[model samples]
Target chain A: MDARSLSIDGLPVPFDDGQTIMDASLAAGIFIPHLCHHPQFTPQGSCKLCTVRANGRYVSACTMPASEGMEVESNTPELNDKRRTMLQMLFVEGNHFCPSCEKSGDCLLQALAYELEMLGPHFPQFYPDRPVDASHPDVLLDFNRCILCELCVRASRDVDGKSVFALSGRGIGKHLIVNAESGRLADTDFSLADKAAHVCPVGVIIAKRRGFAVPIGQRRFDGEPISRRVDWLARRRADDEEEQ
Target chain B: MSNSEPSVRPATRRCLATTSLAGCFGCHMALLDIDERLFELIERVDIDRSPLTDIKRCGRCDIGLVEGGICNAENVHVLREFRRQCKLLVAVGACAINGGLPAQRNHLDLGQCLQEVYLTGPGIVHGQVPDDPELPLPLDKVHPVHEVVRVDYFIPGCPPSGDALWKFITDLLDGRTPRLGHPLLHFD
Candidate 1:
């Protein structure tokens, strides 16, 4: 297999011929924070979080395919500030009650905020009236807590063969919705075992009865700051696995 | 469902073909990431027409694994083709089984969003909208594969966990009916 040489932040790197810029960056030990583009999933490019300067323009590192002589910059104060804005956009768009949620310690969205030094959501909270759906008897749907990452949507639609979950609105006012016929989760053929349930990056889609089962600090992603290699790798792995 | 039923005989090693419509490939990649089983899968099931394979379509296959929701015209056509050729059609991720996250955007008006993105938004290259034949046409709504075509099995996960994927494939190979037991295997 032929490997193409590319430059990221002026550093020369070799990328597999067909690899995406994100893959090349990860393989070369450069971590670009992203919420939606998981390694296991196809690059959606929906979340603008992973936006990086490729050549001269800002392009999503996850979706931009690696090519010969490509110039990439994973980090810069400007990029970091832009990403911080994106993180704030995510926080304000929906409910992200970090203090009360179980995924607080290990949540990627929360960690990204911390890394970018986002003290508070600068934008006014959209605060849509999303109801908590606990009817399934297995998984919980606290729409308020959802980031609308579409991981669940992709999981159900792409991975699980069940197009049960979807993001309903467009632009800044989007929300994840149930199927067409029933409009309620229980009405659809969806069950607790679907990929959509696991795809939620926030506490929005919680397991029905398992909210407090695991202590907050002991959660898989808690305690350890995301800056360390092991934790960083785990976050990267989880980002790739977020679809699950 | 009890696990008391004895295991069944395995079939001849064959190929697995997969396609994804409006979705990310996380679940599919997670399927491959079942590291231990992955080696055995490479040895046993020949992967064809997969995203990794670079082959979009193939002549024949034992299993057709579909990921993503059927959102557009192309998706419907692809789903029908997969239903047509494969012996068993498996909805391998949340999207195929339940319409997943991309379906969330389905609740909004397609025309309005198109207008926002292509006409009035910040990144529009062409300011004036063209009503010519060359312009991309929008679909009415996004639907799941099972709605359009019959699906034989469902693998559930955000991206289905490695253990679940391995079990699903091995069960299919061994002629056992895959059970949609847990929500993690089947909701969101």
Candidate 2:
């Protein structure tokens, strides 16, 4: 693993041969905020939260490969402001009731909104009608909280090999759907052990009976900002696996 | 809510007004949550036209902290009235900023919702939709305060913590604009 070096926000960052810019910067403890790029899954640069400037052009850091001598500018005032607006847009696009959400403290969307200092949604709320699916015995699927990140889709297809989740529609109409023809999670082979069950960044995929097991103020992201360390998802998986 | 750079004003004892519209009044509770610090705040500012004073009408105010979303004609009237009287208006909670939980009804048909609740629901012998003339007409959808008027600050939490409100109000009274820090800057 020869560590190839590049500069992010004028600081030197190193990467492996095939590592994307996000992998390199985050591995070096430089935070480029992202929602869709899970370390375990293939990079889907759909969220655009990790957009950074290489030389002079804007590129998604999670998908763009790191090249030596690349001058990457990730955290500028302009970029952060745009990120805040994007966070705002995500809020209004979905019905995110943070107070009532069981996933409030640990949610990446909520945490990122906090890290970005998002004041309000900054636009009129979409308030689309989304159905909650409690069809599975151990899992609960509340579609209202989804941000369309597709981390669950990637996890189910690539890691769990069940392909239990898939996204349907186009643009604002785009939404998450179950793999079953009946459009129900109970009809599919989805299980509590599947990675898809654990990958939702919002309150969409909550485990039954595990609500508020770790109380608010003591939960993850409550004590630390998202940029505090790079391995929250990995730590969360490790913790869940340990319990199992 | 404390994103923009705050311009300094003359350090006079600022007059503060507060109101709740289409909200649970939890934010006002959080404001009292400042606990003993309320006394300190009272010393620094003049309170007026709020629930704490029971004043129905607003006068000229230096700052107004608005809690909750706009859900009815009365809420609209109160919001505009506050805006006209207050120099700087702050959207003080999740409902006030983003239409929080009350806005959940936006996706549903309002008439159907009322019918289900009042007319056709269980345990109703001869129920009818209330058509009192004194009642304010409900808006078609819940709207955040900013949609109706210009909001100078946005502090986004279900009910923003007492500490957060204290920090914001103190800063405003001191003629400084504040930026809420992390953890304390929570949305939930």
Candidate 3:
């Protein structure tokens, strides 16, 4: 009875102390359309995909602390329009060819684009020069598809205790870098078993030798929308946290 | 609104022109994938200039469905002509909207690509990059249809599914703005 509650899009959801708006919402099965947030990681609020209006002000749901009597708006026409713009920017800023990428159906970026009804990559494509590193026998690093979500950075540093990934440079020059001096996944002790390897939300981090294991039509977000998969993903992440 | 003029009440069937520029005709295949529904469609719209109809050029038409990215001088010329002939131009697929797979070479120099594929590539015996006068001059970069001509609508799939095209066609014929929502709105 002492638990405080906030309403997201007018849904009264109760939250225990210390939970962010995102934490309480996801725990209550409300998806905020975030890519940077992981259930177990300390939410860095880097991606800005979780932007929401808290008490009539725009703020990141993952970083904003839940407060009593706080009215938040997560799903609205204006908010979705802004989020759609973000997705479009994400699409154009990198070389994301969903038709060829192995992660097309399973890609969170592509699934979210479909859920939000993104018609095209609205902005001019950067077509940035990127490298494909296949040095690791078990993994492939295709930087062309990175969205700068930093999920792998978090999982590596916090969970695997490897600190193998970090964001380098500044401004548009900012990019993901391998921690090893040799600048390769194989140079570092990055096994396929690491949580970092499983954390990429796009095609950037791919497993080697196992392409199209599941057919595209049957893969994640192919039969159903990402909105429907949020609960299952949330539950899985929660289970992982409990195990830890 | 048809009067008793009878000679011509806009000819009933709206003329539709479709074309592929730098694409593999996969979008056209999707159009054909309309399958038996093609009969219902044929009754409504008349095919004007298309590879399917084997017409050389389209005259004034009602709607134009353009597929593929603009990658050469000929593509630009054809697209401009299509714009002049059609009242409403719809970019029909991922290539037409965002240059799709063909745009992957945007980062590399055109000269470099030609050099690698022809002159310097392995197992080549005196291979030379063709500069034939008959060939269309390549543009420096591939661009979406909207980048070249004003696109009235955009359908974003690698090649949109048959159901998606059918929905768009039915909506256009029914006087509703065509929208591919939810499951139909896909990029790959």
Q: Write the per-residue lDDT of candidate 3 for residues A25-59, one digit (tens) a residue.
A: 98888888988777778888887878999999999
Model 1 spans with C-alpha error above 4 angstroms: A227-244, B1-188
Q: How do the predictions measure up, each by TM-score?
A: 0.53, 0.94, 0.93
Where does the lowest 10-residue lDDT sum fall in candidate 2 chain B? B4-13
Candidate 3 Cα errors over 4 Å, as ranges: A238-244, B1-12
The Cα RMSD in angstroms, rounded to one decimal, for candidate 2 relative to the true structure is 5.6
Candidates 1 and 2 compared by TM-score, better number:
2
Candidate 2 ranges with C-alpha deviation above 4 Å: A1-3, A233-244, B1-11
lDDT of 3 by residue, B1-188 (tens): 97666664433688899999989899999999999999888878899999999998988999999999999999999999999999999898888888887988888899999999999999998999999999999899988787787888888888899999999988987889888876787778
What is the alpha-carbon lDDT of model 2 when measured against the actual structure?
A: 0.87
C-alpha local distance difference test of each model: 0.71, 0.87, 0.87
What DockQ do you compute for every candidate structure? Answer: 0.01, 0.65, 0.68
Task: Locate the minimum summed-lDDT window of 10 residues in model 3 chain B.
Answer: B3-12
RMSD to truth, every model: 24.5, 5.6, 3.4
Candidate of highest TM-score: 2
